[model samples]
Target: MIIKVRLIPTTGRNEVISRIGSVLRVKIKNKKVDDDAANAIMRTFLADFFNVHEESIIIVKGAKGKEKTVEVRDKSEEELRKIMDSIP
Candidate 1:
């Protein structure tokens, strides 16, 4: 599923913040990088969180900004959606 997740890059401890309404707010774990700040980390975190391969998640938009459109491959989309739907 293609979803927009707002990312917050902080100094300590990575965490998935609570979802409020249609927006999924996430605090990105801080990681110093040569390129984009922790985009890879975010992908990896989501992949592990959703129990999917890193290749299965794509940053469809906002690679350099806070709000990102993440594409979780079909192999996990249904599973992802169900889990997301269960969230308040």
Candidate 2:
């Protein structure tokens, strides 16, 4: 499934904050990290969150910006929503 995400980096912890329409708001915990590192962190977090392999997550766009377009392999939109809804 392809999803839109707004990544907030250098936060307290990696988490899915909320979903607003088509966009998923997420936060990453690594402070002082570069853009590449932040993207890696986002991929890893999403992989674990969606119970998919790290290679299954891809940043399709906005690699250097807060807003990103991601491709998640082997998951449907409905399944993704279920996982997102379970986030605290």
Best model number under lDDT: 2
Candidate 2 overall Cα lDDT vs. reference?
Answer: 0.84
Give the poorly placed runs of model 2, Cα more than 4 Å off: 32-34, 85-88
* Weakest ten-residue segment in model 2 by summed lDDT: 29-38
lDDT of 1 at 61: 83
Query: What lDDT score goes with residue 36 in model 2?
Result: 87
TM-score of 2: 0.84
Q: Give per-residue CA lDDT, model 2, range 4-76, as digits (tens).
A: 9888765588888888876888888866333888889999998998899999999898888889999999888
- Write one digit per residue (lDDT tens) for candidate 1, span 1-88: 8877777767776667778765677666674422275788888888877778999889888887777788888465567778777655
| Candidate 1 off by > 4 Å | 31-35
Q: List the residue pairs that clash in candidate 1.
A: none
lDDT of 2 at 80: 82
Q: lDDT scores for all predictions?
A: 0.74, 0.84
